[model samples]
Target: MGTGVVVRALSGRYELLDPLGQGGMGVVYRAHDRELERTVAVKVLPAQMLRDADFLARFRRKARAAAGLSHPNIATVFDIGEDAQDGEPIPYLVMELVEGETLGDLLRRTPLTPAQAGQIATAVLEALEHSHGRGIVHRDIKPADIMVRFADFADFADSQARVKVMDFGIAKLMSETATRLTSTGMRIGTPAYMSPEQADGRPADARTDLYSTGCVPYEMLTGRPPFTADSPAAMRFQHIYSRPPG
Candidate 1:
């Protein structure tokens, strides 16, 4: 498709509109699906990324991993397809359009109270519990990867919000390519929140996500990640050796 041109996908069923954001791997666009008659989010890898056979394979793997999951706290994957516009293959993923700010974005404005942060962490743990039960480890669970939607919670001591986890990794997809696409020496998962095993480049399991999960609430309540470093390598070293502040 041409720049600034509105194009249809899946044989003119979905209409693409202005982009929502661009990340290292894909650009997300707000779109309309005539068949469903509702707004949705579409994430697409640039046409150039498609040329790499390995990347394409990993892309499909990530899509499948997210697609297999079904939970309210997890973003819903609606469809996966390649653009048929003029033979340029741009792979795209259709997802539920969430209306809220990321936990990271909210924290930047002001830190949350302990009670509020605890509530958010509880919701995230609920989501993680489900994924873990199915043998899926999120691998990346920082504040930026968590979404908070407005809701009522008067009965509970926790904050009134619904949490949604974003960007659950599909094994090798993140381990191999995320940093490569960004031209950064750092690994895919943010350094501060990375579990020791992940930071050390050891194979990760469900416990890896649990380690990152512990880091989220620390930042939420304290306004900083448990560890800090000037560089990715330094951060990895801290994760492997330093103890978090009490």
Candidate 2:
């Protein structure tokens, strides 16, 4: 909390190597598991926000829920641990180091044929189905939250592509407190993909995920998000009332 950084080995086992990506809560890193002798992704949550006993309890519960998932299309959560940094406990989750490009990055660089889009969509649905069955609703679903790997981009096929849906129970933790999270510089739900209920600050259910997932494929095929507006506020309005472009 004092330093505004998580720069040391977690629990003296997971060594932070390179930062992979970052979001509102914390940064994810490509790390080495000295104990297990393997490569893994470590997501370190901000230290200051976790000092409260109630908040830390909630984090452990949600992290456990996210780690319980098992599916081919969902990245695996291997472990959760904490490290002391200047007398503060920094929590971190060890996850599978998925080797792939984010779907959002892919779309920016390459065009997806209908076949490729369909394959990716099916994989996402399957992942969602498994999570929804477990009563975990991914409140935030967007292109960036999905990772896709292919045997080779030049000769893409259904069998060659692998899809993994990420940050499942993570968003659900932020769902009930969108205003507070936003105040802390955390993005709640992505505008273009959020359902009407989410845009209106309502609790999300399985249908909310379906609504957001529908937008992913729609964007994949159309070369743009189905609905676009000048600002995030306007985008939320469109999500609530307007139909996306066909």
The window of 10 residues in a row where model 1 has the poorest summed lDDT is 180-189
Q: Count the backbone clashes (under 3 Å) in each candidate.
A: 0, 0
lDDT string for model 2 (1-246, tens) is 322334567888887888888766667889889988999998887654563456666767887998999999999888887777667788778899999999999999999989999999999999999999999888788998899988887876535778998888877664444445556565555588889998888877999999999999999999999888889899989998898876
Per-residue C-alpha lDDT of model 1 across residues 56-171, encoded as one tens digit per residue = 66777778777888888887778877765577667778888887878988899766767788888998888888888877788878887788865643444544777888766543
- Kindly report which residue stretches of model 2 are placed more than 4 angstroms away from their true locations once superposed: 1-7, 51-53, 175-178, 184-189
* TM-score of candidate 1 relative to the true fold: 0.86
lDDT of each: 0.76, 0.83
At residue 246, give the lDDT of candidate 2. 64
Which pairs clash (backbone N, Cα, C closer than 3 Å) in model 2? Answer: none
Q: Tell me each candidate's RMSD, in Å, in order.
A: 3.2, 2.5
C-alpha TM-scores of all predictions: 0.86, 0.91
User: What overall lDDT, based on C-alpha atoms, would model 2 receive against the true structure?
Assistant: 0.83
